[model samples]
Target: MANTSVQTEPGTRRPGVLQAVLLLAGSCMPVLGSVLLTPILPQLSAEFGGAPGGEILVPMVVAIPALMIALFAPFAGQIVDRLGRKKLLIIAMFAYTLVGIAPAFLDTLPAILATRVGVGITEAAIMTVCTTLIVDYWHEPERRAKYLGLQTIVTTLAATAFIAIGGAAGAAGWRTPFWIYLAAAIIAVPMIFLLWEPNKADPTDSHARAPKVPIPWRRIAMPLIVGLFGGFTFYVLVIEASYLLVDAGVAPTDTPTIGGIAALASLATAAGGFTFTRIAKVGVNRILPVAFALQAVGMLIIWFVGGVPGVAVGAIVGGAGSGLLLPSMLTWAVGSTRFEERGRVTGLWTAAFFFGQFLTPIIMGAITAAVGSLPVAVGVVGIACAVAAILLGFGLRKSNMAPAEEVTATV
Candidate 1:
């Protein structure tokens, strides 16, 4: 039977500010855990004698989790719906902490890979559940849009900070970042007490135990297109920016410095997200095409520009575009769905989004290997993103979906 137990309200009940902060904190930990190890991948390769075609291994550490998340996220939606968002989040936090630390003790590549796989599982659980929880907590369209923007900002800031710190720490010893996971893990402890499960699920009510909502593929089509192109642009930049810098005469050790500079793109994204609430009155559909155009222009700059200044320009433009794109796409998707099916819709959207991220490294790695220059491969990927953006622009126009009502309730 179709599930009728889920709440139909467009926004979450008034969970206090403290509880909301705890929930956002819980969401941030897994993202930090997932990317914190990126800077140390080369060190791991050398220590473990990873193979020559092994550049893929470095990204695999990050991409594998995304791949697994894409594979299992649909099922995870049902699990969260059956259980509760907080319950899965706690379990995911525990798994993230343990798996994040396991690699430090391992001497072999296979063992490290195994631990990464565990990290992937934990990431899938955390992401799928936390997104659902956010929907539950913020029902107002405008408030939810702002919160989603904040969420993206926090995620980008965490990723940027951890990557920079991880690179510096790796210079001291590769194991140092893993220790940081301990701190992220302990956060779950306080979260356990602070988070309250919604009372909508009555234990005495058997009718509440309804079947899970099926995946909402139809409503998600536009978001998936935007996500795929947006993810492609972002991941391609991340995977190949260091190489591009290196090719232009930057040293390998200086790669992190270049990466940090490129990370300013995320900052631009955050800025765009923050401003979107005010500008959303301009219309999401109208704004979306502009976002895609900015990203494409950034890619063009990266493709044609040969120096640090060019890369910086590209990052800022692309970042702003992405920042505007993600929240708008998410708001649009959620607006199209009923509250009861929000989890399933979000799960599918995230899965598709991450699937593009998962594929970027593998595809770029193969192209890099075949062509022997990372910059050229990334340029190709950029071109592809540009094409996709153009295609998605037309698709959104043709769909003619109505804008979602803005929610105004405070946390």
Candidate 2:
């Protein structure tokens, strides 16, 4: 059901290495705001303490973007469908750079948080468009899988670098990391001349028209449901690992130690992402159980052992599984969808995953409160994930008619 009719050769003969890299670079931009300011939360908290709810609001500057993506990505997806992917992407990147840098000059914490929301809105457009274009640019299943995997790998790696950069920039001043937003301008330049709309109506030919397709609600239902949990599992370690480290006796101010742990986890995630294409051969049904099991085991290790080494080991194991989770979800959501619907579907996929991410802390907090232990709460979520994986494997096995049906039918 992959859309094979579109003329992808907009300006070039076909998508080349440069085009693939450009799209991957776009994917990386969405995650930049996630951890780019983590190292400086303390500084922000101190500077804004006089403001009402500053303790709570100051830290949100980093977290609000993902929440915004969760809330607004679906709308962005609708825009991508009605307008065009290239236009939205170009605008989002430019807007991201502007809003991202707004914090550097703004004096109030609320004002900066407002800019962060703008950052998220633009990122919602960017991530959805980037992912949609990946499917559009490549119709072949193997190539699609390869690019998706590469996209995840590149983004995870960039996140690690951004964390370090954030730390270095944070040392100069709380707002210094905001300067990195300017890099988007450099990326936008290449996009202007190189990025092309694949499913767009031709400007030169009045007769040329793209066919419209209805959204396949039934086809995407399972993938969205799975993606929600997949996102939660993907982010559990990143959001809570620092606190786990502190619980293990590392000083709260030991940013280096905590950052190092995060970097190591991201490396594990990159390793997992690199394996996506190879693991894909087994089918997504078989893959999820193992991925979730790895996550379960990693969480259990951190829960029982409770230390830096334990947390690191858990992160490595969990990170590997998380690495494959996203590409698998993307493949499932779009494997049976047409090119025309890819943008809207991709937006839903982005929303599902990010909403899961936004919900993780609140859900995990509830579990922790109920159990009165953070490690145990993480462990409980891990157990739930493992159970879900097992049930999904069995259900998919029965529902999938053939090997090829695995990705489209039940995955």
Candidate 3:
């Protein structure tokens, strides 16, 4: 309820490191929903073995939130634009904690899946608002790019942690991992005191009274489409690398080696994120293609190269591209929008990304089935990404996805 302006206007204080760190922490919430329960799906299936639709509903417990995020993020964006960012984020944070842990006590699969819907809806708001706020609080391009890159790095790291912790905690019982939802409430504590709304203008400000500018939907179409590809490629390694390793002859029980390769891939991704902060000045026009090119190269290696060495190499290289992919596409999508329309633009980008994630497995499955090989399916996707990289590199040369030049409000 305190003043919500984070800008360094005459009176408002500019948000610094603490705010960025909090936003990064908040960004990891969806990752928990995505990966935290991954290791416990078998247990969940067993727990509700007798329930109607248990087989399908069980996998949905992990997938439904992402679908909700994809479905509702644009609506959440509208809410952020109209209702303000901090209030929606705070309300959703507490709501997230409650519904997030609800499964611990639920008896039926349907009931638990319903709570996952709540988790998804709240996550839609949480992700939209947190991302909007990160750039809002840090308008300076270097600072903004740094945090954006860090967001990918931190969340990627968190996904690994969540999976491991989920596995470890599942040793006690499937319900125990749900307790980790407490992280949201714990993060909400500092947020209550430190996080403030960006651009909370006084009634007297002329621009504050000006009519809201509509988002340039046409201008954003290609970027969103490109983001769809980026999103699909981004999650390819994260979701499919384990199967890739197994297919390459690693034993199913060789978790440490598998985990090591996965971890190496993650570190490679974090390296890509770190690279983004330094290369961001080149603009998304250039960086976008490079990211995809890297991904394509890795996938091609998997198809043509073969063996555990090839698969491991492919994962690491593909992950590095993924690390660069998100931040570049995000900047490309929302960098031109002003404060009035930023939330909606960011929401659209978030939707495109998550929707691609939702489709990745289904699409990849079809590709694998049609071709009768996982590496070949991945190669086909990689070729598609390669074409996109070439096209974007040429087509976007004239257009720069640079952040809006002015931080001040404009009518």
**Residue range 132-227, candidate 3, lDDT tens digits:** 887777665556666777787898787767766776677778788899998999998889899876664642122344468888888789888987
- Candidate 1 vs candidate 2: the TM-score winner is 2
By lDDT, the candidates rank as: 3, 2, 1
Best by TM-score: 2
| Pairs of colliding residues, candidate 3 | none
TM-scores, all models, native as reference: 0.86, 0.89, 0.85
Candidates' C-alpha lDDT: 0.67, 0.78, 0.78
List residue ranges in candidate 1 displaced over 4 A.
1-13, 45-53, 199-213, 369-372, 402-411
Residue pairs in steric clash, candidate 2? none
Q: Per-residue alpha-carbon lDDT of model 1 for 353-392, expressed as tens digits?
A: 7777788887877877887866566566666666766776
Candidate 3 global Cα RMSD: 4.6
Q: Over the stretch 296-408, how does candidate 2's per-residue lDDT look in tens digits?
A: 88898888877888888988888887887777777777655666677788888888888887777677777889999888888998898789778887887876521454343
